[model samples]
Target: MAGRALLVFLALTILSSSVLLPKARGNSEGDALNALRRSLTDPDNVLQSWDPNLVNPCTWFHITCNRDNHVTRVDLGNSNLSGHLVPELGKLEHLQYLELYKNNIQGTIPAELGNLKSLISLDLYNNNISGTIPPSLGNLKSLTRLNDNQLHGPIPRVLAGISSLKVV
Candidate 1:
């Protein structure tokens, strides 16, 4: 009888952990996206679907996720979004494309963006963004675009090291 009870307890523990583990991982990405939602002034309500109470940001509009539910892209270009970018965006480890062009977004690029090892394209052109481009962006090995923003200061020499880079 005791053996049966022990088996049941173990099964319950495993079951609960399996269910909660995914939510825990999704929460990090969701929390990061929610931070961005809070920072932006979405006049068009493009971010209306960004509800933090949801299980994950994968269900949110403008956010793309992989099979594992990790955010892989953020397609918010020309959506009339304004407001400075939050550093919390750097938490998206699988982010590939960050399209926020043609908006009124201001403030300097967060240096923490260098943490996105999987980033491919980072489009922030035609915005009101100002300040020196963060040199840490040099860390993106697959970056294709880094142009047309209001940034000043000598382009980071490190960016020249990346062969995938097209326009800087």
Candidate 2:
């Protein structure tokens, strides 16, 4: 009888773990953004209002969320943010819109940002960012709006194939 009970307990533990693991992974999305925030040097204090302690980034300034409570938009245009874009920004798997235009951001556009498969619009215009636009950005098949920036490189042919692309 004790053996049977032990087996049942083990089964229950496995069941519970399987149910909880996805939630834990999903929570990491926000944790990843928080990590990215910590990496940035927010000199202009524009990101001062960002409080990671707050329940969700969606509730933070210039952020938006979808019905699933995942971050969908980040509009930090003209905020004078001066820093490097962290690769951790790629962890936002559900991000659809990212607007960081007209800032003092300087650095290579993170290749990891191409991991945002759900992204539809990305506006990085007028920033000081430099480097070759990642060929990985071609993976953003959902992208419809890509704006001008200081990006350098021969345009990737994959980007040219995007049926939804309008401007780059």
Candidate 3:
């Protein structure tokens, strides 16, 4: 009952945000963020500021963008969030840091995240996530940090392919 209502509320909010974006600075990044926002169950309303109508997501809270308006970081650690991670996050070409630790996120890490060649850090510790670590993670050539999770299966040898990888 309550859960269903929450879902409805989230859907309505996103719908409202979508309707406003066309008249604002809407772009692909905003779309990606919208996907991410949709995937999350934000009970604290921390993501309320993530308005897709903005042409640049850089101005949104917990999101950092470069001077070129490219999203570089997403610091959403420990905000009492819960939900599955969407594959749309893989679209942040210039993203360097993706900190999503200490939440209740579940599901597999999307293989598409391997596309984040510019990523330097991916912190997902202390979560309820399951499934094997994606072997595609070996593609993060610049990755230096990876930490605690509830993953199963063998660690991919390709992960060794990342010369800069330090933590696992």
Candidate 4:
């Protein structure tokens, strides 16, 4: 009976681990998003609902999540926000659209953003952003539109190979 109980305990532990793993990873995404929330200055309180204590960002306004609760879109355009973008933004593994246009945000784009392999549209247009675009952006095979930011410096040569890319 002792051996049987031990086997059951181990099985339960393994089962629980499988369930807990995604929640932990999901929380990391929430943490990453919250990190971004802390970095910006929301003068209009548009991001007022981005409460980090929440179980996940899916409940937050302007943030869209997939069926699995993975964050997919972050729409903060034209909301009178300022401050620089954070590297934690790259941790949104499932993110597709990142729209931060028409804000007063200033500073160099974090090259870590290139880690977003699933990004489709990245519109930082009409912002006060500066600095060279990361060459690692070429890793975003799913990228379709990246345009109209205040970015300077010669475009990375690797982007020329991505046929799906349009507009910059």
Judging by lDDT against the true structure, name the best candidate: 1
What lDDT tens digits, residue by residue, belong to model 2 across residues 1-168?
A: 999999999999999888866653245666766776676666667666667566567667677888878898888888777777888889889899889888877888888889999999888888888888888999999888777777788888889878999988
Instruction: Give the range where candidate 4 is weakest over 10 consecutive residues by summed lDDT.
Output: 19-28
What are the lDDT scores of the predictions, listed in order?
0.91, 0.81, 0.90, 0.88
What is the C-alpha lDDT profile of model 1 across 95-165, one tens digit per residue?
99999998889999999999999999999998999999888999999999988988888999999988999
Pairs that collide in candidate 3 are: 21-53, 25-55
For model 3, the superposed segments whose C-alpha errors exceed 4 Å read: 1-26
Which ranges of candidate 1 are over 4 A from the true structure?
A: 1-26
Tell me the spans in candidate 2 whose CA falls farther than 4 Å from its real position. 1-26
Which structure is stronger by TM-score: 1 or 4? 1
Q: What's the TM-score of each model vs. the native?
A: 0.86, 0.80, 0.83, 0.85
State the RMSD for candidate 4: 3.3
TM-score rank, highest first?
Answer: 1, 4, 3, 2
2 Cα displacement, candidate 4 (Å): 14
Judged by whole-model lDDT over C-alpha atoms, candidate 4 comes out at 0.88
